[model samples]
Target: MKVSIIMGAYNTAPTLPVSIESILQQTYKDWELIICDDCSKDNTYEVALSYAKNYSNIRVIRNEKNSRLAYSLNHCLQYAQGEYVARMDADDFCLPDRLAKQVAFLDTHPEFAVVGGGVMLFDGKVVKKTIFNPEEPKKEFLARGVPFFHPTIMMRKSVYDILEGYWVSDRTKRGQDYDMWFRFYAKGFRGYNLQEPLLRYHDSLSDYAKKSSWDMTWGATKTIWLGFRVCKMPLRFYPWVLKPIVSWLLPKKLIYIIHNKKHNGKEN
Candidate 1:
């Protein structure tokens, strides 16, 4: 089956080349990459266009204005013409067999609508590898946290058709992917995460600090509340909705230490 990889680029000029090169070197050749530049001020558009110019399967689009990631992804979806839709970030690189393995899993498991894999976290140098190996994730799992890595996920085209893409509201702006997973689970669409690491996720402690900001915490809380209502989850889970708020209060150094502990301090 053919897979359409959708990516949104903002100010990722520095890492765009590596990200695109990883896609070009994928073991699965039956795929097309549709990247939308979200009015990046840097040379991200030029770099992506350079690759598209040479590769027939790579297509580049640009937003007239500075649209965010959610809007940009939905725009790319309009031009996608493949059985499966995969998500990619301009700042991350994928393993050679990432697409091939994901495609095989989806083809064999008809019940699953989405599939993601483990990721290797890096910051200039390798940090730690996080593995998410869940056979089937349900609403209960989502109540606590997002079980699937957004950029490492691949889903059926029908899932997008049913979910109508990510919720593009001010409340869900930062946690759009989290909101979408809850909505999908509410609709009885199951997901799985492969144990193997198939992507390199690059970020620093500063990025985590920004992600744990009050605004982002509020957005995540709203997403959880929406999920509880839409999925009919128990009211007891309401407190868990505000769990991310606590993370915002923690020190950045502590957060990094906790994250490192989770991965057993193993560097790739």
Candidate 2:
């Protein structure tokens, strides 16, 4: 049983080598890496192709126009031929044993449709903090936030086919993974978290819990409402739909100061 890793690469030219090198250095050798470049402004496609030249298991694709992650992932899925499909971020670092461990768990446990692990949030210089999700997260967990980290997840290829892959629309432009999670549970599938950091996620402290723009935040709020309908969540959990709105309304400096204080135990 082979695992196919699909990644959407944008303007990550400088980080591509290290991220791809992590995949090459994986303890599990029976895997293929499918990277779909999303018409990046930089030479991300060229960087990916350079690796495909030497590694037969690595495949590279490119979109004709600049689409978002949702479209890029769906395009990559068209060429994925594996028992399991793993998600990766172009700028993240994977642990050597991440693939082997995930494959082993999925091989024995047939009930769970997806599995993900904790992630170490880091910038270029230092690890900021570790976010570990619960072991068995039920649908109600959506009331707060995502149960599993997106880039750390590996799922049965059938699940993707059954759920019809990530939702590609204006509503999902900012929160594709979250919408997919809502649909995943609504369809009666189960998921698990390994409770250990399996990847180093690239999240700068300055960008913590902050959307780049008001439009993005509003889009996320839209996604939350859409997810609420998909999950058939109770009205009691409705307040969470306004979380992005509230967070976005706050001053950026205040948001950063609060986030920096919580994580670093002191204000930035």
Each candidate structure's TM-score, on Cα atoms with residue i matched to residue i, is: 0.94, 0.93
Query: Any runs in candidate 2 off by more than 4 Å, and if so which?
Result: 205-210, 256-268
Largest lDDT belongs to which candidate? 2
What do the candidate models score in CA lDDT, each in turn?
Answer: 0.85, 0.88
Write one digit per residue (lDDT tens) for candidate 2, span 1-268: 3899999999999999999999999999999999999999998989999999999999999999988999999999999999999999999999999999999999999999999998887778898778777788998888777888899999999999999999888767777898899999899999998878899989764655446587788888988888898889998999999988887888877776665445321111
Per-residue error for 23 in candidate 2, Å, reads: 0.6
lDDT value, candidate 1, whole model: 0.85
Q: Model 1 over residues 118-231: C-alpha lDDT tens digits?
A: 888877577455655465666787766777889999999988989999777777757789888888887888898887888998867876765766777888777788788998
Instruction: Please name the candidate that would achieve the greatest TM-score relative to the true structure.
Output: 1
Residue pairs whose backbone atoms clash in candidate 1: none
